[model samples]
Every structure is written in structure tokens, then in C-alpha cells.
Target: HPWVGDHPLSPKSVIRDMYERALTFTELVSHYELARTEGIVLRYLASAYKALDHTVPDDLKSEDLQDLIEWLGEMVRQVDSSLLDEWEQLANPEEMTAEEAQEKADQVRPVTANARAFRVLVRNAMFRRVELAALDQVDELGEMDADAGWDADAWGEAMDGYWDEYDDLGTGPDARGPKLLIIEEEPQNALWRVRQIFDDPNDDHDWGISAEVDLTASDAEGRAVVRVTD
Candidate 1:
């Protein structure tokens, strides 16, 4: 097939548009991606593009792309106050079998109806965030995962599994109470987490924990000691 002319909607233009969208859509995407089916945000954007013009990227088929658009339209319609409840479920995991967890997520996400492309995008996005969060927690814990009974691939699988189990379990402002940040005291292995209550229901919460050898003598009493057991 002959190459399309250097028109406004050229291949190069499409590629650039994809890149630009990635950057410009970061914040809006962070909100949605952090919600559920983050990739749905991207797919929704792609669907919007398809609406403006007939062509979609070579990597994505028209039907697959259109399905994403329709799915997003449904999301736009159904999304409401209940979104918060769903978010809460994601933040706090309730005891459930893996299959049951997935079933619950499917109810919120509707895995059966969405196209493969949209699903792939959602999974990819969820995995990405889970990996980053796991890595960060690992660093903070200073615990060796090499002996955690998993290889690299296995580790990835574990993280993905955790994400699948909880990512879509619920939605809303976090109800996990306050995030705990443990800081080490002068005594080796002695650690304590800062206790703080969250006042605002809508505000996002984050806390940092670092390995500390010691604080002033007066500060010792203020910092509570935490013990970890097998």
C-alpha cells in the first residue's frame, strides 16, 4: 500500500498524538488508573480519536478500539457516588478467595463485555502501579525478597496476583484509617510507627518510613516500639 501523504492525520502525526496524549493525560489518567482499569483512560482517549477520524493505530484494531469507546461511555454513565465504595474495597482487602475476588472485580469492571485491547491496557496499567508500590515497600522494609520463595518471574506473578485480588474489589476515598510509618530507634531492630488520624474524608493519605538509628533522648518516649513476628 502506498504511504499516506504528509497530511494532518499522517502516521507520524498519529504517533505524535499518542505521545502527546500520554503526557497531557497523566493527571486525569492517574485518577482513573488509580481507580480501576486505568488503561480504560487511554482506551477512552483512543476511542475519542476514532470518533474524530476513521483511522486507528495499526497496533489496535477498529472493533477493539470501538469497544473501548463504548465501554468508556458506559463508565461515564454508570460512574457516580458508588465509585468511592469501590475505591475503599481496593484499599482494604476483605477475606476472599482469589477467584471470588476476581468475580467481584469483574462485576465492577465487567471483564466479559470489554474488548481484549481494553482489558490488556487495564491489566498492564494495574501491573505497572503494583510493581512500583511493591518495590517501594520492599525498599522501606529492607527485607530480602530473594529468600521469599520466589524468582523474578514468580515475584512479578505474586504482585500481579495481589493486584488482581484487590485492585477492583472496591472504589472510594481510602478508609484504611491512617498509613503507618515505622521508624527505627537507637536499639537495633527497635521500630515504631507514627500514629496519626486522617481528618478529611476526601484527602489522599501517604506516609514515609525510613530506617533511623536514633532520635534525641526525649524523643525516645514519643516514638513507640514495633515488633514484627513470623
Candidate 2:
């Protein structure tokens, strides 16, 4: 009688409902895609970095590297070049001319305290002999640091093995080949296509494509064909 008075729903029903609420990988992938389209991924990554106590570089404006350069200019103005070298030498305790030491320190100082701390992390990787893809781990570190309970000791404990393992594996991410996606729209039509030749992501050199079309033909209804290619 007492148990019946306290609740109306059965425990089995509650458990089943809770299990149904869990997200599947497909649902998660769909959510991530939507978030990516809405720029939610950028915001999430930025927030994650902030939570980790990791310094985001001032220059990273939504993942752009130009912001880092702009901030570097501003941050460098107040810096006494001579003092920077001293700090660097102090950090490494290496013997060198004040000027030389300052140069080294100055080069590295602009990397501190900004939203793209991950880039600095990549640079740090070079010294430790870590692969470039390990840079991707920044996302995880950022999320951990962003947590309110994170502290220096926790950071050390969490990152120590991560850093060590990366140092031992000196490979980078797989090469992302070239690919292009083109999207075009007309008054009455839409077009999308993927062209293989121009899609190589690693190709720094550019090549032009030739197009032959009759200009005199009337494209009635302005039915333009838009093409999207990846």
C-alpha cells in the first residue's frame, strides 16, 4: 500500500525510457553535421579551449591564422626584446648571448595566451618529436581544461602520457588530397558537381581549365545551371 501510494510508474518503464533517451552514433553524427553547418562546431571548440585553462592565441579569430599575426603585433609592442631572451634562457638555462637568447624567446612568446593555443601546441610537438595529427588531440585537452574542476595538477596528469606517447610517434596526419565542390544556382535551376582533377588538397601549383560555350544562344527563363563539385 505504501509503495503504491509513493509512485505511479513502474521502475522498468522508467529504465526503458532512459535507455531510449541515449543518443546513437548516427544521431551524434547527424547532430555534429548540423552543428557544423550552424557554426556550432567552431563555438564548441572555442569554448572547450577556454575551459581547459589553455591559452588561446589572440590571433585565432574563428580558426583563422591571420588573427594570430595581428595579436602578435600588438602583444610584441610592449615586450622588451632583451627581457624575452632572458626569460627563454631562464626556461632552458642555456648559455648564450643576451641578444641571441632574446631572439629565441621573442619568437616563441607571441604564441602564448590566445584562442588558437592548439597551434602553439603543434609547435611544441615539433620539439618533442610528435606527429602533426597529434595536434588534433588539442580538442580533447581543451574540453578537459574548460571544466571548472581542472587544475594544474590535473592538467599534468591528463596530458603527461598524451604528450609522451605523441613524442614517441613522430608521424603526421594522412595527406589530404585535392578535391573541389562547386555549387551553382540559376533563376529556375540548381547545379552541383565534383571535379577530380582540381580537388587535390596538397597541390600548391595551379592549373587552369578551358571552357567552350556559345554566347549567342538565348538562355530563356534565365534557367541557369549551377554546379557544385568536390
Candidate 3:
């Protein structure tokens, strides 16, 4: 799409706004990707440990995690082989020539390695959680009381106040948690906004572009637009 006039809402300006919104959406989706990766790592850990005849440590046994794993296992077992094959073909695209397939595989190899590294980090964190729980049990000290002059409520209020101020500074849980919640609550609505600008035919706004371009098409077009305008 070309910007032909001096209009404020030119094609370039509209594309920029769409790009920013899409970028924000992708950032939100990345948080869910991390969660999915964690679930995959957990499943791998459970399966590997079982295969090795290792007992699941009591401290490491989360009921929710176990339930998720069992549900995933059942889902996998119930998947139709034909449907699985069709999904694999759709995802991998067997129509590619040998060279194209190899190039694609080469591109994916680094991503596979990166995912493996992330899985290792997640596994280590899981082990660390168990270790921390064990240490907390070993070092168990009873709660503070009036005899010790440590008012539990007052201490809690002070800590809460500190954390509340920290959160106000945007360095606490509220920073990401609320954003994720907002995006996740109605993800289809967020997606619909993007589609409305770029794909919807009856929309008022026009970006002066052909509809149904690939998601990554913006990168090359954006670079071209910048180079020409600069």
C-alpha cells in the first residue's frame, strides 16, 4: 500500500497504528507461550522420572500439575492417528522441495535448541522449588506472638503497604498480571480490532492495502516503506 496524499490518516500512519497494536497483542501472547512451555516441561519431567523408575518427591507433587499431566496423557491417548498425521502435514508442509525443507529445518534447529535450554531452566526451577520447600520444613519456626512483641497483623500490614507502594512504582506483580488478564479476558476482541483495520471489508477505516496478507508481510513492507520515505 502506498501513501499518495498528505492526509493525517495516511496509509503509513494507519499501518503504524496496526503494527503497534499487533506488537502489543504478540507480547501478551508470549506470556501464555511461556506458560505452555512450562506445562510441556512439567509433562516431560513427569514422564522421564517415571521411565527412570524414580519416585515423585512428596514436596514436588502438586495436585494441579498432576491432574493436568493426567489430562494431557489421556488426551494424547485418545487422539486419532489420522487426525494427528493431518495436523503434522499441515504444520510441516511436506510439499516443500528438499532444499526448502532443509532450509526450514535449519531455521528451526536454533529454535529447538532454545526451547531445550528453556526447558532445562524450568526443570531446574522446579527442583529448586522442592529444595526450598524442604529447607522451609526443616527450619520450621512457629509463628511470632504477642510474647515476642511481634504483632503479626501489624507486620503483615507494613509489608503489604511496602509492596503496594512498590507495585505503584510498576516494579511488582500488578505490572504484568493485570495486562495479561485484560488481554486474555477477551483475546478475540483484541484480535477483532486488528482484523477490523486490516481485513474487514465494511470497516470505516482504510489502510490502502490488499486484504489477507501473511502476518509477517508487515516486516518487509515496513522496511520498504521506511527506506522509501527516509
C-alpha local distance difference test of each model: 0.34, 0.30, 0.28
Give each model a TM-score. 0.22, 0.17, 0.18
Tally clashing residue pairs in candidate 2: 35
Candidate with best lDDT: 1
Q: Point to the candidate with the largest TM-score.
A: 1
The sequence of per-residue lDDT tens digits that candidate 2 reaches over residues 102-147 is 5655653332224233222222222121112234354433333334
Number of colliding residue pairs in each model: 11, 35, 0
CA deviation > 4 Å runs, candidate 2: 1-26, 29-55, 61-191, 196-230
lDDT score of residue 128 within candidate 3: 26
Better of 1 and 2 by TM-score: 1
Task: Provide the lowest-lDDT 10-residue window in model 3.
Answer: 221-230
Q: Candidate 1: where are CA atoms >4 Å away?
A: 1-111, 115-118, 130-230
Q: CA lDDT of 23 in candidate 3?
A: 20
